[model samples]
Target: MTPEDLQTALARALTLAESGLVAPGAADGPIDVVAPRRPENGDWSTTAALRAAAHPSGRKALAEHICDHLLTLPEVAAADTADPGFVNISLTPTARARAAIDAACALQPPRGPWSNAGSGPWSDAAVDPNVIGALQLRHAAACRERRRARAAGITTDEADSSTLDHPSEARLLNALAALPGAVDRSRRLRRAAPLVTGLSDVADAVEEWLSRCAVTPTIDEDITARHSARLVLVRAAIIVLAAGLRQLGAAAPERI
Candidate 1:
């Protein structure tokens, strides 16, 4: 589901909880959904429970109550409360898959509030240069890997016998899942989008994908489609990164 979708769902769920819990109007305050740093922590998390716990019912009961209400939503497959208050949300598998594919197809950056010339951390012009340099190095490494595979006389047209299975590929998906939060934060914080957090996530994921994958468009068609997917994801990364830089008054160079 999209950010707006999830946000709306959470709001509705909170509304459902208002009359039943210690929170008379628990849904009155602002709500936030977070992308966990750990992949297994769940697709997203919310502080709604903690927010409501400040009333009187306390954290545990509020967490459970909110989670129960959240579970009633169609988009959410599972909702569970972690200790003290955070409510972790897992979207239905189909929802997660659709979100990933949608992100890949769109591959566009959402507009951010801050610009490079603004008085913010991302105002520096050098960040993109560093990012571009790293991207160049990665591209060169990919070319070299392909060259070696070719020198050993590996055939381009052959298909892999194995199904899709790669750690880096899995990591890439996790990286994509984190992008919306990053974009929203960029806008909300009025900071650069390609800052250390989101941009680094994309870059590190891309770097890992490069090191782990063994296919090349210059030679072989990626039988598992993993390589193509990685390329798509990385392209989205660069597009968003560029948008962030440009908004921040930094020029995104065509070449590093």
Candidate 2:
């Protein structure tokens, strides 16, 4: 799924939770996502509720507050909380597939049929025997490379690149409001620890999603045009992530 889509949904839920808090400002910040360490749990987990535990409204109250709102988002199949208040989110299978398309659109609008060509969503079918194997490695590598490029701000079609955003990792941004200046090392490090941890965690969650939906590519494989478009959608997710990290001062990692 386009992680940002999930992040946007979470952000709205957070907004709802914050509205009822004693200090709405305290609830403001990036909402980190991670693959659940325990398989039995939801697909993505965030500690927004836990972070807001210190709020005047109380931890359980704040936690449940966010949980209630998260449940309202269609993209979120399920929302649950852990002790001390962590909200775990599960995406419906359909939502997961749609997210892949959204990710593709964020990179560049779907071309071929999904665009101004023939029909909508999809108008054809394609098949391949190697639909679920090492091919995923190539997709992963390509995604990582594009991610690197975006991180460096290397410049793609401006319109295409501009469509991607990493609001989930907004905490990583060293915005003027967060610190005294860019050179304030000690303070920056202090405030940034969570952001770094959050990035790593969210990457894992996104990876898990990608791993689940691996398929054929557009160039080397003999897949149908419809499947090719699906790959494009998957590829866009890499750009989405890279663009976001760049905002946080990522040096454009040479490799994931």
Best by TM-score: 1
- Per-model clash counts, in order, read 4, 1
**Can you give the TM-score per candidate against the true fold?**
0.62, 0.44
Compared with the true structure, what per-residue lDDT tens digits does model 1 show for residues 30-106?
Answer: 78876666667777788877776546447777778777877777767788888768888777644554554455444
**Model 2 lDDT on a 0 to 1 scale:** 0.45
Q: Candidate 2: misplaced stretches above 4 Å?
A: 18-22, 108-137, 140-256
Please report the TM-score between candidate 1 and the true structure: 0.62
Model 1, total clashes: 4
Residue pairs in collision within model 2: 104-233
Total residue pair clashes for candidate 2: 1
**Cα lDDT listed for each candidate:** 0.57, 0.45
